[model samples]
Target chain A: MPAIIELRDVTKTYKLGDETLNAVDGISLSIQTGDFVAITGASGSGKTTLANIIGGLDRPTGGSVMVDGNDLSKLRDRKLSDYRNQHIGFVFQSFNLQGTQTALENVTLPLVFARVKSKARKQRATECLQAVGLGDRLKHKPSQLSGGQRQRVAIARALAVKPNIIIADEPTGNLDSQHGDEIIKLLRDLNKQGITLIIITHDMNIARQAGRIVQVRDGKVRA
Target chain B: MRLVDYISLALRNITRRKLRSALTIFAIVIGATSVTIMLTIVFSAKGFINDQFEQNGTFQQVQVSPQTDINWGNGSGQNCNSSDCVKLTQALINKLAKLPHVIGIARQTQPYNFDGLFYGSKKLKLNQVVAYDANGIIDNHMLAGRDITQSDGNGVLTITSDYADGLGFKNNYQALIGKTVKLHTQGYYSGVGSDPVGRQQYMQTHCQNMGPGQNCELPSVQITGKVVGIADANGLTNSSGYTVRVPLSWARGMEENQDYGPARTSGDYCRNMPGPCMPPNVLTVTDELALNGYSSLIVKVDNATNAAAVAQNIRGTFKIGAADAETAIKQQLSVFNIVGIILGGLGGIALIVAAVGVINTMVMSILERTREIGVMRAVGARRSAISRLFTFEASLLGMAGGILGVLIGYGLTLIGNPILNHQLKGNNIGSSNILSLPIWLVITVIAGTTVIGMLAGLYPARKAAKLDPVEALHYE
Candidate 1:
């Protein structure tokens, strides 16, 4: 199948008062449709920055990022936001769920911004939560859930809009081996269902589970 | 996002910090209440002044005062055309009667003495002895009997209930109707007019060596008039609740006799004597021989708007000074309005402090929700959506305050009306409720408060919108 995400020499810079810092520099890569790709790197190797750029949460200072033939660099702020809502999903290490909200409410938040009608949004969010094995915990707030359950809720939230690309940054960083394995397994199952998956991580074992691994060092993809 | 979603989200956030929001809203309520109360006072005061002017005949009448040659407290100041004063003389009274728009031309009497009218042995000491043209004065205050009509002469008069009661007609106060009260225009002296000895003595005691301009007091002609009406109101002597109105013709004729009586200039008194000053020629006065002048002229016009034009015409043609009743009423009303504005301005300051509270709360809310805003933006909310959220929240706060304040204001009016009217009764002001808040006022206050809320939220909303979403996501 054709590549779903393509990066050509994408770069990201940071201003430090006077000196400039390149967070992600001269990076080029591509992933085919439905592929499970792991972006492997040590600390300061720019894997997180690359994940952010792909998620449309951060803009690269240079080069083009094309997802399904739509160049993200050419999109305006409004269109870029729509691109994130329609094409990409993000799961962070912290499992960014609103602590005051129910699991179902947390799942439906993305859809709320997507302006979906209430009845349809609730149905879609409930289905997503059930897919992540938390259907019965729909009314349970994040504080009432275990760490693994909370991570599942967050994963449910990411999948609510049914985007084509899922970007997970250190998805299992805070989990124990058993919980981490469950989350990775769930992600792989989702990838198997024909959704392209990209995981940013330092773990060799987690990277080995993906169909392809792109290793990074000093802000560039290793040859 | 749908408007409902925005509102729901705002509600959730506001409800989360319940105490803070309530306190902020309370500040707004206090501010709104003060403004509401003050404006209501202005509105009511304006109404009261207008009512007072209306009752005083300021709406349809213009007062024309002849420029007093001596000019002490006379109106028209430098604007008074002295030559125009001559045209307002009694001769023009009939001429002015012909002006098509001139509804009525009446002149008040040089006040009749309170002791002049006698009911048998008792002196009629009702309110002021008031007399004016047509039946206008007593027409407004008739309790019994009937007003003195144009055909009524010096032989007819109106008395107040207090005067009727004084004559021991308490059980049948209307009994005074058709009763004749002996009228004496001046003090009584034993045999002054008919006895030569008494006349000589009276002239020596009262008229000897009078000043250059001061005329000798005339021997008043006594003409008894029938009691025609009982006045319900006595504005002049409110303390005694007494008044007596007579026909304007009768009063003017009497005033003319008093002012230019005994038919004499100084030369006619001392120079043209036949023998020993001919015992002062006890001048035989005739109505045609008397000089006719008026203290002031009351001109009723077709309508209030025409009063100014009539006054202007009178001023342009005559030396008499004129005052536009409509203009005077409006001037008096404006004074109260300015006072009310000052009061409202003070209340506005309180509202401003309340607005500050709203601003503080909104800023704090924006700070607390930085991360939530980031999440919304990430999920596809436009920057404008985030700003709109805070503005809507602030406006909600203002709306709550405004509604509560207006309710409180209305409650105060309900409670204050009787108390204020009671206080005003002692001062003789009309007992109308003095706190009117019309629909426009209510709408203005609500819209004003909401606009204030929007303004207070503006800075914080802008700050929230301008926040870097990526950085905001990492905020704790």
Candidate 2:
């Protein structure tokens, strides 16, 4: 089967005043369609940088990353953001739901940028929240919601555009054991429904459940 | 994004910081209110000049007189001695007719004092007899009968209806038409240099040398003219004078027959009478009209616009004291325009301050919403859309402020008018309302303020638009 994401010697660098550091150095990886892939690394081992490169949030300094048949390095800022809007959903480690907006409004943000009508945005956002088990908390603001529910709202937001890939960058990092397991299971259930799910985490236990685990150490992927 | 969505989002943002938005809008309201009020006063002042001339129907003609010591203001009236006065001569009149834009030039005969009005031997000895070209008398108020046209009776003269009533005519004075009162005249040149009372006495002196209805040695010329029309009893002339008008040819004929010499002592010579003159007031008459030229010339132009140019030309050409109503209007309006611009600019300073306030508020709002803008950019929203959002927010503030300002301005005018008018009337200024805002001006002020507000937002909106999404997301 053809791979959904392809990375060929991808390298991301950083300037630390005088020294140059490669955050994602010479990474070459491929993940097939409908596969659950876990990128496991220590805090500074560059898993998040690799996720950013694949998610089109940041550009690689060298080599090309092909995602769903589009060259990620060649896209302009607008085209890159549009590609993320149409095909990739990002779930931040801290659950970046807008605190001022209601749960439903937070979920509706992607669809808003998608140029969806208000009525349709509302209908789809409501359904997405129900899918994430936060249907009853639609009108509640992030401040009013529990930590678990806020993460659920973030997940609902990621699902609002019906993107082809779900990229969860340490999705359960801020949650306790019970909330973390529940969020992981929800992500597992979404992947079982045939969406490609990539989890960027250092937790060995979470990586064990993925169909494949790519271990990142010293900015390189090891089999 | 759709326009409605932009407005919706802006509205929500505005309500989030209620006090700041209100304060910003309030500043603009004060600025726009003053601007609108100043414009109103300026427009009203221009209306005053038109109103003044319209009431008298004298807006179409320019008054030209030979350059002299007197300028025709309302009070400094015909104080010049007409007998010794240099006239706007027929030669000059012919020359004036050839001037561009001059439709026609009219001249008035110098007034002849009343000696006797003989209605079949019934005479009313009275004040001076006045004569002018009929067309020149268009502004006069006609009380009865038709105005004297060149096609009228051989010699037609109009008098005040009040004067006609005293002449044994109908109470209405319309019945005075066709009544022949033989006008008896002699050269009353001596009286022309003196006061009215002295002139009255000089005019009654009969020229004995000339037989009845024949020529007097003082060149007494009599003409029996039918009373054509009666004018109102108001001040006869614009400045004040003649109650009668005659054709130019008749006045010219009268001018030719009189003595053109200077004033003389009464007992100089009586060719037909013996020894010292028997009559007390009788004197040798001198013809003033022939000595000088015509006292004034009325130049009719194409319209009010051309009237000013013609008056300027006449002032330049004949070097005379001349005024067209249109020139006066333009002068008055330009003064109003200057005053209006100054006052409007003074008021506009408030708007500039408000604009700065808008910029400050927009910058603060963008800072507060930096993270939100970043999130939007990370999604599908473009840089232009982010800028548009902030600009729309600022413009919304201005539009609301403009609407409120227009209301406040209109309300102030409504309440201020009667109060201002009372003070104006007390101060002897005109009673017209000073705050009369036209509809187009009101619309323009509101629209213009909104544009200004949008322009004020440009810098802050650009700052917001250029913010890096990755960096903005990391901000606390």
Candidate 3:
């Protein structure tokens, strides 16, 4: 299959006092369409930064990031945000759901930014929740849900826009072993349905389940 | 995003912090209400005064005073015997009549010798007894009967409603019309209608017995006249506050000074005869009206626009004071304007303080919603959209306050008008509901508050829009 995302010598630096740290170092990688890839690293090893650059959430200091034929490095904020909305969905490990809103409302957030009508947004959010086995939990707020259920709700929110790629940054870091396995199974099922999935994790068991594993250390990647 | 979505979202945000939004709006309401009420009063009073002048035809008439520095609406003209004092005489009136835009002239005078007016023993102090040419140049708001016309001669007059009230007529002014009223002169009065023969006999009998430089008391004369009209005391533009008007003919007669004097033939006869011969007594009449000229002349112009020009012409040609009411009205209205500015400025200060409240509230809201803004931006909301949303929310606060304030102001007018009307009626003024709020005022107040809100929102909205999404999303 053709490559859906390509990065060439990507670098992201942060200034801390007088010391410049390269959070994302000069590294090149490619991921194909419908590919299930896992990026494994120790803490502070820049795996999350790589995921963010791929999702268009943060810009690299020097790099050409090509996603589905669009050069993200050259895009302005408006187009970059549009790329994130239309093509990429992010799932945080903390299940970053609005504690004040219902699961369905949280899912509708992306669709609202996409300018979907309210009725259609609701319908699509319901379908996404149902796909995540959370159809009956649509009206439940994050505080009312279990940790596993809240993660599933976050996944449903990420799935609402029907994006081309899903970036899961330590998707199961906060869950117990059983809940963590359920979340990984849900993401693997979604990957099987032809959505390219990238999981950032330190767990070797989760990384071994992916079709490909890229282990990152000291801001460099080794496949 | 659609405008509806933006508004809905903004409304939801505002509702989230209901107490803060309401408090902010309350401050604006106070400012708007004060501005509304103050401006309404000033504008309405200005409108009322203009309406009064328009009804009286004062705008079309130019008053010519003998004094060079005379102002319109003042009846005190120059009554000097000096040659420098320009007398408003018949010759000047004729020359003024020939001036461009001159339509007609009404000579005005006040008889100063009257002490009281008697209606069936109910004596009332005469404040002013005025006479003017019944040439339709002067208008009176008659309560009953008709104004003194050109045909009205001696013994015909019009008394104001205050006189009627003192005469026990009060609201029944019609009953006083056509009734005989006596005007009593002062003790030393020797004007028209005095008994010169009686005065001479009294002097002959009393003066001989009194020592030199001793004074002899003269009985006051009572002149009778029929009330032709009862006018509103506060309705006359030139003469207000308890006035009584009489025909010019009667005033001419009243102003005559009658005196007892020796006949012209007696002087020669007494010179040729023995020393014991007495001079024949005769009565002489002096025309004081002709001697003093009319106090002031009201020259009517063909149009109100030409009144100023005619006044200028009269001032230039006759060297007398000719003032159009427009100038004086403008001068008077400027006082209202000054008062309006002062009052409106007070309201503006309140609004500015309220705007500060809005800014504080918005800045606080932005701080609280920083994470939400980041989430929205990540989901694809443009920076402009976020900025617009916050601005809309602020404007909504302003709009709500403006509407509420205007309603409260309208309610106050409703409550205030009746009391004002009662006071005006007590003062004999006929106008009512002088606290009107025009549509433009309502619109301006609302729009002004909305604009103020938008301005106050700009800073906070810009701050919100410029926040970094990555940093904000992880904000604690």
Q: Write the per-residue lDDT of candidate 1 for residues A1-223, one digit (tens) a residue.
A: 8988899999999999999888888999988999999999998888888888888888899999998988888887788888888877888788877878999998898898789999999999999999999989999999999888989998898899998988888899989999999999999999989889999999999999999999988889999
| Model 3: TM-score, first chain | 0.99
Q: Candidate 3 — what's its lDDT?
A: 0.87
* Candidate 2: clashing pairs of residues: B132-B245, B216-B219
What TM-score does chain A reach in every model? 0.98, 0.98, 0.99
Over B108-212, each residue of candidate 2 has an lDDT whose tens digit, in order, gives: 545554465666756655444544566643456787876677655346777665457557664657667767767666544233232334444333575434467
Alpha-carbon RMSD, each predicted model = 8.0, 10.5, 5.7
What C-alpha lDDT values do all the predictions have?
A: 0.75, 0.75, 0.87
Judge candidate 2 at residue A4 and give its lDDT: 95
What TM-score does structure 1 among the candidates reach? 0.73
**Cα miss at A154, model 1 (Å)?**
1.7
Tell me, by DockQ, which candidate is best.
Answer: 3
Q: Quote the RMSD, in angstroms, for model 3.
A: 5.7
TM-score of each: 0.73, 0.69, 0.79
DockQ of prediction 2:
0.32
* Index of the highest-lDDT prediction: 3
Instruction: Report iRMS (Å) of candidate 3.
Output: 1.3
Q: What share of the true interface contacts does candidate 2 keep?
A: 0.32
Q: What is the lDDT of residue B78 in candidate 3?
A: 34
